[model samples]
Target: MRITVLVTAKRNPDLDGAACAIAYAELLREEGYDAAPLVDGNPDAEARFALDETGWARPAVSMSASEIVLVDASDVVGLPDAVSAERVVEVIDHRQHHDAERLFPRARIQIEAVGAAATLVAERWRAAARRPRGSTALLLQAAIQSNTQRLRGSVTTPRDLDAAAWLAGIAELPDGFVEGQFAARAAEIVADVDAALSRESKRFDHPEGSYVVAQLELPGAVGLVDAVAAADLARTERVMVNLVDVDSARSLLLIWDSAFRRWVAARLGVTFTGAGAECSPAVLRKQIVARLRGDAS
Candidate 1:
């Protein structure tokens, strides 16, 4: 029972990762490829919200596939052992750290500096002279908006804006779709802090130590910093909680273990208060991780 091609998101996937995988799989299927989306880990709150709102089917985990197409991320660190470089047939990524051409030299690589991987997926769909329908269009649109913070994020590119606009036009969604989605995600996080944090956190194992980076956007900043679920991720060697107030475009960072906190503070040249540090102009979790790896683009 050999599967031809399987598309998967990196472990601890968020809305962008999961949506891009599913949407890209749809594109592959439309092109007469036997493709299916597989989730490497449980979906986070934002991903769950997208699935629920868009009504897209939940993806299964099993993968007995001959080839793999990775979306949203291209790093081997977060992927399963089964996904080797040879098995990788394609990779669509938006981050700077991944060199798909270098890692999977024979694979079809599309690594751009766009705000979201979904933007690239949308571009591919358009390039094929096809339009995504219903949930596919909605999910891709939502992914671009979420990743780019409704085109207000520092990393947002013109490609992302155009792709999102095209998707919204096809879906017949209102211009305020992003605001509604952002509000809903924040409400979901506020309703259950522990569930939200655990779902959003992604773990990384480095030469120095292992750590978890958790992030969630809120409607507002009130009472959010104190409500972070740092203790829930006790298994992690260190924890970094990013609390974003979407309404104000502000962010706060909370770190556990004084040594790690101090190290991060020194790196950013910020005050290491016992409470939490404010990240002015608000950086996303992806940006923070990139900075840590010295791969910020």
Candidate 2:
């Protein structure tokens, strides 16, 4: 059957969603499935998919043309109403929980709080006795290692470790390469505190209840810890910074403003809790919406 794989990632170079999609598509093709990887919201439709910097052409065909669609659930916030596909499948993801039944009722939901969706795909490949060769296996191995922080993050479960071990055996990844990449990336943060803080920004939304979230992607030349510290220092209002390491599944929640900070610390079980005076983008958006609605909460 003809299948179209929808892959997505936060607009960050480090996340490597396109690479994972390419690898998975190759494996699927080897299995005799006509599979092609499509970037979820790509504006271009001709150029082959690449990292954030690469240009891609938007596919001209409709989603209904495919017999089946596999979506990278990590970055699929909402689906277009124009999509009339009969069958849609979801792959691995670790985004915040949402109303899946209401959103995509026909989808095969598989949400695991793992580091990367590629890890989940790799497990599926192994279970099916699919031995991806050459570059496919190597890319999968890199995706897992980068997502798991070289196996240092708390989200690195036993299953993830197992998948990494198996893929590494076949791919033969160099020792300490992942760790070295992280270190090299961390050394790029300079003394410009404000610019560094701006590297990561957060937003909060209050649909009915207040929910806060942050997103950031530091390049190979930026230090995440320093950026987070700068974010904490720059807080002037009520907000929480959930700094997600797109490469490493590690995340740090920086709570500024005393009241909200304490509430999040107690409720969310944050690993690092402290006080500051910053406001997240989510909080700001909520406040604006509240003001516009003439409802003070």
> lDDT: which candidate is best?
1
- Model 2 lDDT at residue 35: 66
Q: Evaluate model 2: give its lDDT.
A: 0.49
Task: Report the lDDT tens digits of candidate 2 across residue range 141-175.
Answer: 66666555556554456877887788877777556
Which digits, one per residue and each the tens of the lDDT, describe model 1 over residues 245-267?
A: 66666677887667788767776
Cα TM-score per model: 0.78, 0.64
lDDT of 1 at 180: 67
How much does each candidate deviate from the true structure in C-alpha RMSD?
4.0, 8.3
Best by TM-score: 1
Stretches > 4 Å off in candidate 1? 1-3, 11-13, 39-42, 58-64, 76-86, 99-106, 174-180, 203-211, 229-238, 256-259, 271-274
Candidate 1 lands at a TM-score of 0.78
